[model samples]
Target: MTASKLYILDTNVLLHDPKCLYEFKEQDIAIPMTVLEELDDIKDRKKNVSSEARHAIRAIDHILSGASTSAQITKGVPIKQNALNGVDTRLGKLSIFPDHELTMRQGFLPNDHNKDNLIINCALHLQATNPHREIILVTKDINMRLKALGAGLLKVEDYRTDQLVSDIELLPAGHYQMEGNFWEHVTDVKSYQEGKYTFHQIDRSILPNTYPAEYIYDESDGFAARVISVDEETITLQDLNHERIMQQNCWGIEPINIQQAFAMQAVLDPSIDLAILNGAAGSGKTLVALACALEMVIEDKQFNKIIVTRSTPPVAEDIGFLPGTEEEKMTPWLSAIHDNLEAMHEQDERPQSSVKYAIEKANIQFKSLNFIRGRSIQDALVLIDEAQNLTPSQLKTIITRCGKGSKMICLGNLAQIDSNYLTPLTSGLTYIVERFKDYPGAANVHLEGIFRSELAEYAEEHL
Candidate 1:
C-alpha cells in the first residue's frame, strides 16, 4: 500500500476556498500555527474575506471536536468522510503543528518575522521530523512556492482542485467559426421565423457541443447567427441582424466591430437576462454596457433604473480609509464608470450638467458590494464591473440577488484580475461564462478589438 502524503496548506489556500480541507484524498493535512494566527487576524475583515476565514476556522474546530484529547490533535486525528459531509471517503488524518524547532536555513533568515518564511520553515520542520512520509507545501502564492523549493523542499504545488482550467488560453471564447461550407449545409436545415428574427433548426449531430447564445459565423459567407436553443436532437439558431444592430445607436455609442456588435445584440436583447463581456483592458466593455443600460432604463423605459457595482480589490497600495458616505467612498473605485459616462455625454454633445441631470432623473445608483447581500433587486439593470476580481462564491451571492424582471451584465478583463486569490481560469467571470453557456436567456461575448486608443492597444500588445 502506498503511504499517505503530508500536505501543509497556506493561509491563502484556505481564504481562496474554505472547502479545500476535504479536497486532498487520503492525505494527512497539516495546518501550521502561523496560518491559524493569520486566519484569526483576517476573520473580522470585510464580508468576502471574513466569511471565508470564519468557515475555515469552523471546519478546523469541527474536525478537532471529534478528537478526544490534545494528544490526538497533536499526533493527528483521523479525518472521517462523515465529518466532511461525505465529500471524500478517503481516511486520512488532520493535525495542527503548534510549534517548530528553530533551525538555520541558508536562504531564509532565522530572525525574519515574515509569515511566509515562517510557514516555509514549518514545512521544513515537518519534512525533517517525518522522513518516511512525503511532505508537500500547498500555496497559491507563486513566490512562496519558489522560496520553499529553494529551501530544499522538493514537493511544492498550487492548490488546483477548484480550478476549472489550467491555463487562460483554454478558456472558452464564447463563439465558434463554422466550416467553409456552412452556408451550403444551412440550406438543408429547417427554417422558421419569430418576431423580427429568423430561426433555423439544425441536427445536433451536425453541430455537437454548441451552447445557447453562442455566436456561430461562416467565414466563407457573411452569415452569422446566435444559438437560441439546443436539445438532444437539434439546435435552433436566430439569424443575427448585425446591420440593424450596428446602425442603431445606444446612448450615442455605436458598435465598431463584429465582436462589439455581437455584444451589443446580447445586451440589447430583452430575452437574454444575463450577459457576460470579457476582453482586453481597452476593449470598451464598460462603455458598451453602460450605453445599453442607459438606453434601456432612460429611453426605452424597459427597466426601472441602473445599478452599478464592482469588486474593490486594490491594484497596488490600498488607501487606509476614506471619510464620506458610501457612494462618496466608492468614487475612487468607480472612476471607470464616471469616465465612461462623461465620454457618452461628450459624444451626445450634451452639456456637462446634463450628465448629472441624467444620473438624477434616470435614478442611477452606485452601490458597494458589501451591502448587497439579503436584498432583492427587480426591474433594474445591474452592471457588475471588474468581475474578474470576485470569487465564485462572491459572484453567486451577487447574481442570486437579482429578482424578477431584472437583467444583469457582467464585465471584466480576465488579464487584469486584482485579487490575489483569483486567476483568469478561477475568476467568477470565467466561472459564469463556462457554467451558463448552455442555459437559456444567457449570452457571452469576448471583445477583441481595442477601441480606447492606439497607444492603449500598443501597450496591451507589447507592454
Candidate 2:
C-alpha cells in the first residue's frame, strides 16, 4: 500500500499512549533512534512513567520483531492490522529512523545534545529523502512542536490519539440546569411509582443531550431528578427530594450546595459503581467523597474497607526514600483525606480519638497509585484523588483492578492538573466522565463554588 503520510513520533507521544502505534491507520510511522534511547533511559527509572516507557518499548519491539535485517527494519515493517481490534483496512508501515547517523547540515537545528533537536533533524532528513511524501513530527510537548516548526520541519502536530475532547468546556458536568421550571419543558410525561420511589417517563426532546446518572435541576421550581435510563423516544428520571438530599448527613458532613449534594448522593448511592467529582481546588471534592466513603464503610456497612489512592508527583521518585510503611509514606500526599476525617470528628469531645476510631473501624488503607496495578480490590471503596494528573490508560489500569462489590470514587480538580503532559481535555477524569456518561453504573458531578473558605472562593475566582 502506498502510504499517505510519514509520521515521526516523539518520545512523549509514545509515553502518552503506548498503543498509539496502531492508531494512525494507512499512514507510515517513523520512530527516531533518539526517542528509543530516551525510552530506554526512562524505563529503568523509579517514576510513574517508567511503566509507560516499558510498554512503549514493548509495543515497538512487537512491531519490529518480524523484521529480518537492518535494511528491513529501516525500510519499514507492515503493521499487522488483523491483530488490532479486528481492523481489516490496509495498515501502514512502521520504521525506525537512524537519527544518530544524521550529519549536521547548514541551516538545520543544532543537536546541542538535545534529543528533541535530533528528532527534528531526523524529520528534516526524512523530508529530504522522501521528497514527495508528507513528513509530520508528532509530539506531546508544546515547546518541542514549536522548536520542530522553527527548525524548518513542516507539519508539526500534537499527539491526539487519547485526547477525547477538543475543548474542556465541552466535557460533561454530570448535571444540567434548566432556565425555568423543569416541568415546563416537558411536553409529554408519564409518572409511575415503584418501591416508594417516583419515576417520570419524559419525551427525549425534553433533554436531548441528557445521559444516565446526570441530574436535571430547576432552581425556580426547586426540583431535581436523576436520569435513570434513556431510550430513543423517552427518558426515565427518578424524582429526587432536593431538600432531603441536601439535609442528608454523611459522617457529620452535610452538603453545602446543590452540586455537592448531587455528588454526595452519587457517592452514597448503592447502585452507582463509579462516581467522578471534579472542580476547582477547595471545592470539597475529597471531603465529600471521603465523608460518603466513611458513611458507607463505617456506619452503613455497605463495604468491607476503604482504599484511598491518589496520583502523587513527588512519590513517583521519592516514595521509597521516605521512612516508615507505605501508608505512612503516603500520609503526606494524602494529608487532605486526613484533614477531612479530622474535620468530620472535630465536633466530638475527643476529635483525635474519634478520627482514630473511624480509621480502624472503617479499615481505611492508604495506597500508592504505582503499586495498585495487577491487584484485585474487592468489597471496598476505592477513592482516587487528583485524578486529573493521570492519563486515560493509567486510569484504565487502576479502574480495571476493581473486583466484585467495589465502588470507585474519582476526585479531581481539572484546573489544578500538575502533570506536564496532561491537559484538562486529555485528563483521565475527563475521559471517563465522557466515556461513562451513557453507562447506567457511573455518575460524574462537577462541583462548583469553593466551600473551603471565603478566601479560597475568592482565590478560585480571581486568582
Candidate 3:
C-alpha cells in the first residue's frame, strides 16, 4: 500500500537541477502553482534551459493527466506515469487533486516578494486536506528550508536521484592514515625526470588528498621529500618550485588544502594561462578558483569582466524556442552562476548589490558556449564551471574565447560528467590535465574536502 506524503517544491530547486521531480515520486506533490508560473515565465530561455526543461514541462503535463481532481484547485491528484509518456515513477499509484471550481484561485494566493512563502502555503494547503499525511517542502536553497522549518514543516530532503552517491559513501574521519616511510624511491631526480624512476610503498596504497607523504631519497646524497602523484603514479610531483606564494584564505572555504594550495600556486603563477581543477563532489576546487579570480577582479583591477560560462546537454529539453530577448532566455540557466556570485560578495561584505550591479554593468556575464564562435573576451576573469561536461573540442572553443590579459579557470568533478563523448577519465578536465602536463603556462589541481556539509560530503561518497 502507498503511504500518504505531501510535498511542495520550490522553483529554484527545479531550475537548478531538473531531476528534483523523481525524488518525491508517488508522494502527494503540491506543485506550487507559482512554480509553474515561474517556469512559464522562462519557457523561452535558450541557453542553459535545455530541451530537458521543455521535456520537464511536458513530463509534468503527462503527470497532470491522471491525477484525480477535487471541486477546487486546492486538491492534489495522485500522479502516475503514462506508459506512452515514458515518465514512469516506478512506484506509481493513482492520485487526485481538489477539483473545486475556484481552481485554487480562492486558496492562499502568491504575491510579489512571496514566491517562497506561496510555495510553503501550497504545501500547507495539501497538509490540511490530506489529514494524516506527512508534509514535506523539498528545496535546495538553505534559506528556504530555514523558513519552512520556522513555519513548522517537516520531512524534506534534496532531490537525490541525480546525486552521484549517498550519505553512506563518505569516507569517515579515520579512513586515511600516513605511516612512516610511505615511499621507496627507485631513481634519483636525474633519472626520475628522465621517466626511469618508479616509487612504491609495499603493502600500502596512497590515498587521495593526504600529503606530506614521506619519500626516501635513494640518491647517493640520501634525503627525504614529499611526493604527489596523479593517475596511477605515472606522473608525480616532488615540490612546487614557485618563486613566491601568496597569502589569502578562500571565502566560505577552508584554508587552501595541500591540493588546492598546489592549484593556487599555478593560478597565481604568471606562467600558467590554462589550469584545470578536478576533484570529488565536496572538493574546494571550484570555490578556490572562484575566490582567486574574484581577488584579481577586485584587488588587482586586472580584468573588466568575470565572464562565467558553463554548458548543459539537452535531452528533448526543447525550451519551446528562444525568440525572447537575451536576458529572458538566459535567466533560468544562470542560477548557480549567480549563487556563486552572491556567495563571493556575501563573504567579502561588499554591498550584496555588487553582484547585480556587476551583471547590469556587463562586468559579470553568464554565457552559454552553444554559439560562442567569434566572440573574444579579453582581459577578463573567465570561469568555466562544469567543464567536466564539456568535450575537449568544446573546451577548446571556450578557452579560445579568452582574449589578451584574460585568465580562465576550469572547475569540475570528473566523476560527474554530463556531456556527450566524455567519461570520467576522458572528460576535458582530465584531457586538459594530461595534455598540459609539461606546459609552463598550465597547472592542475584536484581538491578533496567537504565544504558544503558533513552530510553532503557523506552523501557525495556514499550515495
Candidate 4:
C-alpha cells in the first residue's frame, strides 16, 4: 500500500491566512512539531497576530482529534486531521496519533529557531521511513522556504488560502472568447452591453499601439462592464442602471499641457485596471485616480461609493496610533488623499447639490483603509491610494473586497515604498499588476508625468 502524502504547513502560512488548513484538499497537512512549538509562543504574545495564530493552532488540532488507532491512521485518508502530538507522529511500523507523548526529545521546545528546524527535520525524517510518501513544506516567508531548501527539504509558497493566485499561468483562468466580426456582430455597443466583457491575454508591459481591441473576443459573465461612450479623455460605460459612465480619458485629470493627455487616457481606461506612476512628489497619481473615481461615482453613477485608502505601512516601524471614527483614523494615513480632495473642492462652485449634489445624488460611501474589513463592497469604485506601502497579501485582501459591479484602481509611485513589509517590486500593487496582467478584464497603465512641477520630474530624473 502507498504511504499517504503529507504536506508540512509552515507557521508563516498560518499567520498570513488563518484558513490555511483548508487549502490543500489533496493531502493531510501535518503541523511541523517545531511549528506548533513556535505557534504556542506567538499565541501568547500581545500582537496583532497572536489571536489569529492561536486560533489556527486550535483549529488544526480540532480537525484530527478523532484519530487514535495506528492501524486506522495509516490505512485510510487522514479524515482531515490536525493534531500536534509533541512526540513524533511515527512509531516503529505502528502509528501513534496525537496522544503519543514525547518521552525523550531530540529537538527544540517550539521556540522560534528550534521550531523551524524541527518542522524541516520532521519532513526529512518522514521521507526516510515512508520512502514512497511525498512530503512538501509550504510557507509564505521566502527566507523560511530557503532555509528548508538549504536543509534538503522540498518547499512551496502557501497560496491555496489566498485570494490572489500567485503568478499563475498567463492563460485565462476563464475567458470570454468573442467571435470575429465580433464588433460587427453587436449592432450597437448599447444593444448587447448587458453582460460583462473580458479581453483575454492582455499584456500590460507592451506598448499601447500593440493592444488588440478588435479581438476583444470573450463574453464571460462576471462583474459586468460596458463600453458606453469613448472620448479622448474618457471611455464611458453603463452599469445595470442604464446610466452614463465616465472614466478618465483625458490626458490628465485637468491637464496643463498636451503631454499629460496620453498618460491620463491610459489612466482612465476602464479596460486598464492597473497602473504604475513613478514620478516624484507633485505628480498627479492621487488626483487622476480621484477624478476618475469621482467621474464614475457622480457623472456616471457606475458604483455606489468612492472608497479611498492607503497602506501607510511602516517600512519597518508601526504607524502611530490611529484614533476616532473611520474617517478620523484615516486622517493620518490619507494626507495625500485629503490634499487632492481639498484641491477638487477648492475649484468647485458650491452650486446647489454640486459637491453635495454629486455625493448626495450619487450616494457615495467613504471609509478608511484600516476600517474596510468584513464588508462586501459590491458595485463600487475603489481607489487604493499610496499602494506602494502595501504588501502583496494586504493588496490581495483589499482587491478581493471588491464586489460585483466594482472597479479598483491601485495608484502609486514605485520609487516611494513606505511599507516595512515590502519593497518597490514586491509591494502589493506591483505584485497584482505583474500577477494579473494576463486577465482580459484587467488592464495596466504606466503614467510618467510629474504635473505638480517640472522641477519635481527633473529632480526625479536628474537628481
What order do you get sorting by TM-score, best first?
2, 1, 4, 3
Residue by residue across 1-463, what tens digits does model 3's lDDT show?
5457666666655654454455555665666557777677767765444433554567566656654553323444445443345664454332323212113444444434476777766665666666787877777666777776766566655544433323323312111323433234323332244244233332123344433222222233222223434344333544332212224454334344445555665465454687677777766666677666666666556677777777756545555655566555655655666676676677555756777664655466766675565788788877788888765556766788878888878888766766533455445555565555545465556566777779988898888
* Candidate 1 clash pair list: none
Q: Which residue ranges in model 3 land beyond 4 Å of their true spot?
A: 1-247, 250-256, 314-324, 347-351, 357-362
Model 2 TM-score is: 0.96
User: Which pairs of residues clash in candidate 2, taking residues 3 or more apart in a chain or in different chains?
Assistant: none
Q: Which 10-residue span in candidate 1 carries the lowest summed lDDT?
A: 100-109
lDDT of 3 at 319: 55
Scored by TM-score, the top model is: 2
User: How do the residues 1-463 of candidate 2 rate in per-residue lDDT, one tens digit apiece?
Assistant: 5697999999888888889998998899999999999999999986678899999999888889999899999999988876566755557999998899988988579879988888889998988888889999998889988887887887999888777788999998999999878777877789999997899999998889998999989968478899999999999999987778879898788989899999999998888999999999888899999889988998889999999998877634554567889899889989888898898888899999999999999999999877899999999999998899898988999999999999999999888888877888888888898899789999999999877899988988997
TM-score of 4: 0.55
lDDT of 2 at 28: 95
Weakest ten-residue segment in model 3 by summed lDDT: 168-177
lDDT (Cα) of model 4 = 0.53
Q: What order do you get sorting by lDDT, best first?
A: 2, 1, 3, 4
Model 1 per-residue lDDT tens digits across residues 40-139:
9999876457777988999889878978887789778777677657655656788998744466655543646788988888888888878998999999
lDDT of each: 0.84, 0.89, 0.56, 0.53
Q: Per-residue lDDT for 263 in model 1?
A: 88
What would the per-residue lDDT of candidate 4 be over residues 59-178, giving only the tens digit for each residue? 655554556654554433343323333533331111222311323234322424455555666666655556777777776566767776776665445444444434423322111234
Cα TM-score per model: 0.92, 0.96, 0.47, 0.55
